[model samples]
Target chain A: MAQNASQLEHFGRALVDLGLINEELVVLDPDVAASTKVTYFAERFPERFIRIGISEQDMIGVAAGLAASGKTPVACGFAMFVACRSWEQISSSVARPELNVKIVGSHSGLSPNADGDSHQTYGDVAVMRVIPDMKVVVPADAPEAVEALGAIVDTPGPAYLRLARGATPVAYTEGCEFTLGRANVMRDGSDASVIANGVMVPIALEAAGSLAREGISVKVVDMHTVKPLDTDAIVKAAAETGAIVTAEEHSVIGGLGSAVAETLVEKRPTPMERVGIMDRFGESSRSYSALMAKMGLTSDAIEEAVRETMRRK
Target chain B: MLRTINKNQVLILTNIPRVPASITSVLRGISRRHKIPLSTLKRNAQILKEFNLIAYGDPPNFSGVELTELGRFISNLTVGEEPTVHGNMVQTRSGFRPLGTVIKDLRKTVLRMIAEAGSGHLGASLSAVDILAILYMIKMKHDPKNPSWKDRDRFVLSKGHAAPALYAVLSEAGYISPDRLMTLREIGSQLQGHPDMEIPGVDASTGSLGQGLSIGVGMALASKMDGSGSRTYVLLGDGELNEGQIWEAALTAAHHGLDNLTAIVDRNGYQLTGRTEEIKAMDPLADKWRSFGWEAMEADGNDPASILDALNACDLTTGKPSVIIAMTTKGKGISFMEGNKYSRKTPDAQELKRALKELT
Candidate 1:
């Protein structure tokens, strides 16, 4: 049986692991080291870690400057702040110059449950995807988060790694090979495909399993890299499956759903449906699961989206 | 004895490799690339040979010229390095002339480039020229030959609209050829309207205001972490202080105790629209920095000696970042254009001539 793991914890541990080998790896936190779990890396590598005391814009500029001076800086903060609050700084300083700055946005989407819409970030993926030379990654699970972290650090230029706050079902075992722009097909089917990322990946897989009992085949793909969308896999899935449904714990406007829809419209024009927050803000809920359910980001919603897309096909 | 080589002669010497190349090919290449006349290239090449920087292949029908040992050394030095002796004058890495002479030349270049481009921030560029000259010439520890030298001090033009000044200083410092200065703001030119990382010797690509000090803080922090002894300097416009990000960075710098970072605010009293005070009252500016825990200082920004004195006065071991509020006139050299409205105005042909005369 697969156990649940925290993506933020895996991300923090991965930074420490990478810091041990790569001397140029420097971690920057905007005063949320404890919440973001970057404290793990900060504890082991105090000299390499810089606590920026809640200034996201300054954190980004500093990251760009460090990158300009030949140090690989990973600036971490909440998605709501680091992605949106400092979007201009990220675009001008880091993306325009193509600096090797890895920006991590923890507590993304509805995962920041009780914090409500103010703390939840549904627009990060959309904003980050729009910047040129910026690679957007949202890992599916804790183990995959570690792998994704290593891959982004190894690759040059600016990258945004989106991490959910709560623990997620482990989708991959340790040492899974994670490529930057390629999508991983979790399960292959013929009737329709469900492409998702972040917390939605596990939910999509569960949806697929449920549909299998109902004599429906659903392909599940973890579309981790959002900016450089895996168009090849998307086209392949659209052609083979004949229909597609996209799921994400973010706004349907510009997250994984839009990325897949744009590709499908241009390349394959397959029948597709997007399962995500429908242009509304989230509210404080009892737990992460309750908030996600209230936002319609569950295995049932993904199943409904797939069945609706199959009907259209 | 080596005579003081003009910009044309320096261009010729640096273009030719240490290995032998035909004089005709060298002349043709330099003429075509820099758009200089073939005759001028020939004269400069001949001067280089006379200076013993280059040697003829043979006495009868000298077919080619190659850099002599001294020629290679001088050429290497021309790429913004140590000084070279030429009669009574010394050619430092900053320029081939004295500091005052180089600054006057830079002001002329800034005006002429803006005039040629037909659009640019004239007053702001002129205001920053002297400070840029002092930094590139006397203050900053940088090597044009190796712009990415790990331990070299970094300078960020946070007030990126003054690119003409930075470009003029860079050309004088040999990071770029002087002829390239004419291509300012032109399509496909490396010297963009704003400072870009593509240009040589540019540490960070900056144009949007209020973002530079944070970058400097990062560089300073990286230097501190590596114990790399390299310093980072950032220049900001006074009007740019309207941005909240500037104060945010100021607090972060002082909080980190980034002693290696020095920020200079070009208090020219004018912004894009109107007077800075009229737009946003930033009085007691130095006090604001002081309150944020920086060691605030003041300087006559247009005066090279004053700027240098203020820069030298910074105590780097105090474990606190410093900010110098350098008070400057918008159009420091050109008299008629010394007003707030000239910030974005390009000098016409007559204005360029008049400005050049004033600079002389």
Candidate 2:
């Protein structure tokens, strides 16, 4: 974690690089180019860029149309608006046809901290996951974000890649192999397991370290791809570690926590606690840290949830 | 699906208000078929005259009411006869037998399919027949043999309820076989209740209103980016204009200066419930489009030659999108269905037979 990096920035750069190599690659934005960091690509390849201007539903439809025309369209916009406002379009136009449109929803969760509740998205992950044939991915850090972009580019059909607005600690080193529908194990412990994704991954890793110093060994798993939840990893974490705690920057209702709980309940039935935003809207905060701390979305929250789950075990 | 608008609401009727002998014959035919009293038929004919649906014409004792130009236009659709046009055929890769003839045939096919499907949108589909026929047969740069050709012009039926018209035109164009028209709205059929791209010649799958414009804008943008001389056309219903997304896409197309995009609105003035003016007054539609930075024009939607003229008048290099506000009757050809309460419903066996006979 020498320098903080943004997953959205990494996504923009990776998409631009992919566009340069892949002639079919095209980017569509809904007036959040600079904020979503898609402006990086827009500046480099002006011809390949389409600025749709503040219409998420229209952007989704356009992207679907482009995909139908044999162009790989990456529709970029804020996570909250793109997922909620145009959920019907995504479902009907893109996913229903199984179009090769990649939806990149930036500023996911509480990342747009100072912008307040309307800007913060706690339900995007849930919304995208439920769409049929939609592949959902939330990268833990910059490197993982780039890898996820590459993976989706190679794959066909509709995929949603969630990216955060603010700078986050770099978790994976360069050349990290990203596999779709697979979890990355950052730490190994038998006492309890902390499964996390997106902005919460580094926090979960820190929580595991803090727990280790207290002689409570903890396992940290990055369940990056949310849709096809890595059942094998979760089952193993429950069977071996005996306890599980799921963390995310999204709402506790239907994001990573819900996905993990659904998997564990049907597979191994382990004691678990979710460390994410409660079922409520976010408010204006001074900073990302303040929002996370206020919402109980910190490493301390993960550690507490881990301890509570371990006690239940 | 039709509900009458306020009878007091003054609408500009396109037909002359006199009853002619031929129209009286049709009314007499209806009276004889339904066993209704001639006095009752005459009273109803007066009501129809109040709406300017028929005009008076004389040949003494044997004279019946005569259908007006508008009435004749609608009646001819039921029997499948092309309206005569002065213009010669405009050449395109897809063969054409004069657009008027093509539209009449397409309208007949649309009505028959609606009757066969047991339930389909009659008014909306018939209203948009000429617009779809002209685009498919003449205006578009499409090849039915190679429906997916990269440079082929695209048409998206944004008002998906009018899918029967698109299916009819697509089938006639050879993108689909005429035999498959019977499978419309059937399970496992490509011809769904709405337009599905799975059906050939349909550029985008659009049933939800206010969405096809955006998809068309997207395709137009793609064509511009690809430097391909392809244009994208989106056919919308006047009722479908109530959806805010249409305006959103409208603004996007204007903002992008997408000259390759054209939106043809079937301004038939009717929605599922009633007159669009009553549901939501979209009067001054051309001005609204003009204010949105589009080159807006109006034409007779049911007339293929007029529609073709308006479409040909569009200048793509002007750096603005074009929209043709086609004024049309809800059910252009069928006398009973035109502006009837059940304009959106399926035609019954008796009505279908009478309609086919009236086409001539």
- The per-model lDDT (C-alpha) reads 0.86, 0.81
lDDT per residue (tens digit) for residues B55-110 in model 1: 87645777667666577556545533323211112234532355677778888999
Candidate 2 lDDT over A227-278, as tens digits, reads 8778999999998899999999999998899999999988899999998999
RMSD of each: 8.6, 14.3
Best candidate (score: lDDT):
1
lDDT of 2 by residue, B311-349 (tens): 766733479999999999888877877884556678888
DockQ of each: 0.68, 0.43
Please identify model 2 stretches exceeding 4 Å from their true place.
Answer: A1-3, B1-102, B315-317
Q: What is the per-candidate TM-score for chain B?
A: 0.75, 0.74
**Residue range with the least summed lDDT across 10 consecutive positions in model 2 chain A:** A1-10
lDDT of 1 at B192: 92
lDDT of 1 by residue, A1-313 (tens): 2689999988888889999999999999998998899898889989999888878998999999999988999999999999999999999899988999999999999888898889999999999999997999999999999999999999999999999897889889999978999999999999999999988888899999999999999899999999788999999999999999999888999888898988888888999999998999999986988888878999999899888988898
